[model samples]
Every structure is written in structure tokens, then in C-alpha cells.
Target: MAQVLEFKLPDLGEGLTEAEIVRWLVNVGDVVAVDQPVVEVETAKAMVDVPCPYAGVVTARFGEEGSELPVGAPLITVAVGADASGGSSEGSGNVLVGYGTSEAPARRRRVRQAQPAARNGRAEPREVPAAPAAPETPAAPEPARPSDGPVPVISPLVRRLARENGLDLRELTGSGPDGLILRADVEYALRAAAAQHRTAAPAPAPVARPVVGGETRTPLKGVRGAVADKLSRSRSEIPDATCWVDADATELMRARTAMNAAGGPKISLLALLARICTAALARFPELNSTVDQEAREVVRFGHVHLGFAAQTERGLVVPVVRDAHARDAESLTAEFARLTESARTGTLTPAELTGGTFTLNNYGVFGVDGSTPIINHPEAAMLGVGRIIPKPWVHEGELAVRQVVQLSLTFDHRVCDGGTAGGFLRYVADCVEQPAVLLRTL
Candidate 1:
């Protein structure tokens, strides 16, 4: 006999609580392998392919596409025995953080007393003793009473919605398969209650307002929402200051041209700027640190995890290059290229989007001159590079048309004073004006 093992949505890491279903890769009757990606979901940070840990024939799916499901909610149920398919099913070692299956998942199971929050959407999480697993039976279209059985709730988010509005779960019947109460049912119930209340009391007069058309309102969710929240938090929390300078980038441009002309692999200007930033960070380690508000301590990082801003159709995302200080210019170029392509394709993982010690914002690609970049939260500084355009400047007491660029440094005031910030900027400018200076650190 096939035991229907329910696979809850495994927790996608990086503090993400919920994800909207973007697409389902498998149907109800489709056969899934262990660790095979079964669904694609969009969290606040990035789009993730959620893989199922159990290998079996998928019997049921929980949520529809385009709907948001909280972490730990039932994602799918797989019949995991020889009868499920020609071959028996087992657990995969490769599983996400929150949930996983042990060996012999088909015969025995651990009843995870997952608080409704993750599965149901509850505050406290506790573990219960393992029990002999049983096959899930099709439930009738009725609410289960308190003494009868567990509440027929599909998502913890629905439970929370009904809870916040003071709706009783046992009073209303479930509408989903297996008597699963869905968000729509709770919302409809709340709306009906609100209408009855309004009927009992006189409603307020409708406020008149001019209707405006041709305005598109896009919901701030996913990457855009994440960016907005982080930027807002940065602005509200960090005491930031911006310092800028114009530098002759002719030498830096020439050096890059020379390196590419004689190179096995072409180097990128962003990579060169990143190299300079790492050097400057080494000179001023305070700029490569984060301020811990609670500890009231400034945490300095030993190595650089360089984050660069890449604008994609999804919005602005900063893809990180880990251990950037250890990477050469050629390696940085390749990593940056790979990450940028991932960002464009919306395939950059959450890990690729976080843990940045210092950010290099090359807004030059947009044909802009300079910008006081908002520091990515938790990180203490950002180095902005502008377009290198031809400008007439004094070259050894003589006016000449040279490739000039504007560099701006935005630093957290709590981390360091203006002297340190200025010194760091000056070092970077000096490197652009004189590429030979970078060789000292190299």
C-alpha cells in the first residue's frame, strides 16, 4: 500500500517567510524524483525553484499558481511506496533548512508539530513524538469540530487572517480539497460579516474625489518590495554622508585597454573599479564594516564580499561577489558577468543577493555623471562611479581633453568620520588618475 507522504513547503532561507507561486513544474499525477525542483516561487529576495524531498507519484497539490503560500504549508502529497510507481520512493539528503525526510520516509514519519505560522502560520514551534504514518483520506465538505479532529486549514496565513478578524475556524466550513479552509473562504466570510455590521449601523457618506485614469499602479512586491524596504530602512536607520570628487580616468581607461589588448580574457571596467575599492577598503577598514545598533559596536569584516548594483526588468538587484578581495581582475570580471546574467534572467539566488560588505554602484552605464547612492542596509559604505566622458582638464599645467569621471562615496557616519571617508575616496581617485598606484597594494 502507498503511504501518502505530505510534503510541506520547505523553508527557503534568508529569513523569507512566504513565497508566491510563480509556476508549477509538475501536475497532480506527475512522477517526481528526490531533490527534483517541483515548483518555482518568487520570494521578496529572489525567484527560487523549490525541490521536493520525496521521490514518488504526486497525488495532490495545495495552492494554485499566482497565490502566496506561507512557509511550512502543505505543497504536495506524494504516494511513496512500490505501489505508487514501479519503484519504491525514499528521502533525499539534499533538502532545505526547515523540513526534510529521514531514511525510510515511506514506512515511518516524524509528526512535525509545526506551528500554524509556518504550516498554519503560529508563533511558537514545538516538536511532537513520531507516530505511525497513515495515508491521507479525502475529507468531506464540512468543518471538523474541536473534539472531532484537527482544523481543516490549508495555510497558516488563512488562519492568521481569520484570527486577526476574530473569526472562528470551527464555525465555518472549508472549501478546498480534503476540507482545507482557504484564504478566499476566510476573506469572503469577513466581507459578509462587515456587510452585516454596516447594515446594522448607518454607513458614512461617500467621499467625492476626482477619478484619474492613465495611472498604472504596480504592487510593490518581490524584488522591488525588498529593495524598497531595505532602502527605506537604510535611510531611516543609517546616519549617512556623501563625498564626491572628479578624477581623470584616462590612465585607468588606458590601462584597461592595454590589459585587454594583451590579455587572454578581457577585463571589465567595473572589475577594475571593484579592485580599487577593495584596495581603498584595505586602507580604510572602517568603511568595510557594519554598525551593530544593539551591541553599539562597529563590526569590521576581514574579507570583502563586493556587491554591485545591476538594474533588471524585475528591478534593481545587487549581486554579490564573495571573497572579492582574493579574486583577481580577470576573475572578478567573469564572476560579475555571471551574476549580471543571472540577475537579468531572474535566476540569481538569495545567497547571491546578500552578505555584501561593501557595494560598488557603477551607475555610469546609464550615462549619468554621479549620484549619492543609498547605502545597502547593514553595509557601511557604497562607492559610486560615473561615466568616463571626455572633458577638458589641466594636464601638467596645460589644458587637455581627458577621460574624466566623478566618484562618490556614501558612508555611515557612525562607522567613521569625514577624514577616513575622504582618505578612502582620495585613494580611489589617485588610482584612477595613476593606475600604477594600485600596483603598490597588488
Candidate 2:
């Protein structure tokens, strides 16, 4: 006899609570090996392939693709022990944060069958059917329920949509397997109600407005939603201030060109800017510190975990470079390239997306001159770099066109005052204007 074991969504760590099912890798009745990826899910941070701990035949799956499930919710049930496939009963040793296989065998519980109701005049307990077993074939669809019974809905979002639109879910039949109510069912009910209202309404007055067409609404629930939430929280929680300066970057550009001409590896301009930011932070450690509201203390980081903003097809993501202060220009450039590639391909893990003490945003790639960036939360500051363009400037008391860039620093006011922020910005601007100043620190 095969003992079936249920697997729930494991905690992906870093305070993530839920994940949306992007795609299912295994189907019911399919054989799977231990530690094999069974499903692909999209969390707020990144896309993850969840692995199954048990090696057996997949008996059932809980949710549909595009459905969001909370952590600890049943994901799938695997029939372990000796079976048709001759698989082992022991679970894999691999472990995620919240789930794993142990050396000890799992204990099984036996359910007691309910007693039948008495036929006599005396009142007796009614018998209740046992829960359905995992089917070898596809799970049977749920039978239609009485009007007074609760609707078969799993997602809270589906219920919320129906409630917000004033549609009663009990009155409609769900299109999903097992007669589970879905968002589409709620939407269909809403559209049918609107059409019925329009048909029954009297002729509209001349002053009445006509219905508009061709408007599409997209839900903000994935990467876009995550970015929005973080930015909004940054604005609300951080008392931020911005300071900017225009610097003649002609020398820095020339130095980069020379380095690439003579060098083993090509260094990126962003990496150069990141190098400068790290050096500036070293001088003004106050700007590198975050405010701990609950502790009522300023927390200063000893090492720099620099985060750089990269815009991808998914949305805007900030991938961090660990120990950036210790990396040289070449190393920083290589790490930046690797991270940017991962960001573009949507392969960045949640670990790559978090744990940063400061951020460097280069919006210049989008053709913008400057922007006051919202600080990445828990980080004290962000350095925004603008496009380096030719501008008329006084060089040696003579008017000439020079390669100039606008640099802006947005800092948390709770961490430092305007004087500290200005000083940090001024030091960064000086480095950009004169690359030799950076050589002193290097």
C-alpha cells in the first residue's frame, strides 16, 4: 500500500508570505524523483522552481496556474512507498527553509468512519462521508450545491472581486474544474449584469454620457506591484532630501577610454561611478548609515553592499553587489555585467535582489538628465547618475564644450542632516570632475 504524503509551499525566506503559481512542471500520475522541481512560482522577489522532497507518483495538485497560494498551503500530494514504479519510501535529504526530509519515518494517522443515523424516533448523530481519496485519474468535478450552502471558492481575490462588484457568486456556475469559483466567473457575472441593466434601462437623455470603449486594465500583482509597494513605502517612511551637482566628466571619460585601450577587461562607466560612491561613503560614513526607528539608533554598516537599479522587461529591479567596497573597477564591472544579464533574463534569485546598504541608480540610460530617486527601503541613500553630454563650460577661464554629467544624491533625513548630505554630494561631484581625486583614495 502506498502512503500518500502532502507537500505544502515552503517558506522562500526574506519575509515572503505567498507565491503565484506561474506554471506546473508535473501532473497527476506522473513519477517524480526526490529534489526534482515540480512547479514554478512567481513571488514578489523572483521566480522560483519549488522542488519535491518525496520521490513518488504525484497524486494531486491543489491550485491552478496564475492562482496565488499562501505559504504552508497544500501544493501537491505524493504517493510514497513501494508502488507500480518501485520507488523508495524514504524522502530526500535536501531541505528548503520550512520543509525537508528527516531520518525518522513519518507517522500516519487513521481516520475513524462516522456512525450512521438512527431510524428510531429518538434523535441520533448523522453520518458524514469521509473526504475523497486522491484519484488515479483526474479528480472528479464537485457536484452542484443547494442554494443555501456556501460557494466552492478557494481564492480570496475571487470573493473580493464579486463582493466589490455587487455580484452574488452563489447564483452562478463556476467554469473551473471541481466547480471552484474563479475570478473569470465573477467577471462574467458582472458583465452579464451590466448588459441586462443596459437593456432594461429607459432611453437616455441628450445630456447623458456615452459609454467609452477600448480601455484595458492590467492588474499590478507581480514584479510591478512589488516595485510600487517598495517605492510607496520608501516615500511614506523615509524623510528624504535630494542634492544635485553638475560636474565636468571629460577627464573621467578619457580615463575610462584609456583604461579600456590598455586593459585586460573593459570597465563600465556605472562601475566607475559605483567605485566613486563607495569611496565617498568611506569618507562620509554618516550617509552610509540607516535609522532604526524601533531601536531609536543609527545603524552604520562596516562593509558596503552596493545595489544598482536595472530596468528589465519584468520591471525595475535592484540587484546588489556583495562587498562592493573591496572590489576594484574591473571586478565591479564584471559583477555588474553578470547581474544585469541575470536581471534581463529573469534569472536573478531572491538573494541577488536583497541585502543592500546603498544604491546607485543610472537613469541616464533612459535619456534623462537627472532624477530625485526614491531610496531603496532600509538603505540610507541612493546616487543617481545622469547622461554625460557635451556642454559649454569654463575650463582654465576659457569657454569650451566639455563632457558633463549631473549627479544627485537622495539621503534619509533621519540618518543625517543637510550638511552631511551636501558634503557627501560635493565629494562625489569633485571625484567626477577630477578623477585624480579618486586615485588618492585608491
Per-residue alpha-carbon lDDT of model 2 for 161-246, expressed as tens digits? 67546677779898888888877788888888878878988566323334465344668887899889899989999999999999
List candidate 1 stretches off by more than 4 Å: 95-214
In the predicted model 1, the residue pairs found to clash are: 116-120, 116-121, 116-122, 117-121, 117-122, 120-156, 121-156
Per-model clash counts, in order, read 7, 0
> Deviation in angstroms for 48 in model 1?
2.2
Score every model by TM-score.
0.75, 0.76
Q: How far is candidate 2 from the true structure (C-alpha RMSD, Å)?
A: 10.6
Question: In TM-score terms, which candidate is top?
Answer: 2
Model 1 clashes, total count:
7
Task: Report residue 353 deviation for candidate 1 (angstroms).
Answer: 1.0
RMSD in angstroms, candidate 1? Answer: 11.8
CA lDDT, every prediction? 0.81, 0.80
lDDT of predicted model 2: 0.80
Q: Residue 249 CA error for candidate 1 (Å)?
A: 0.4
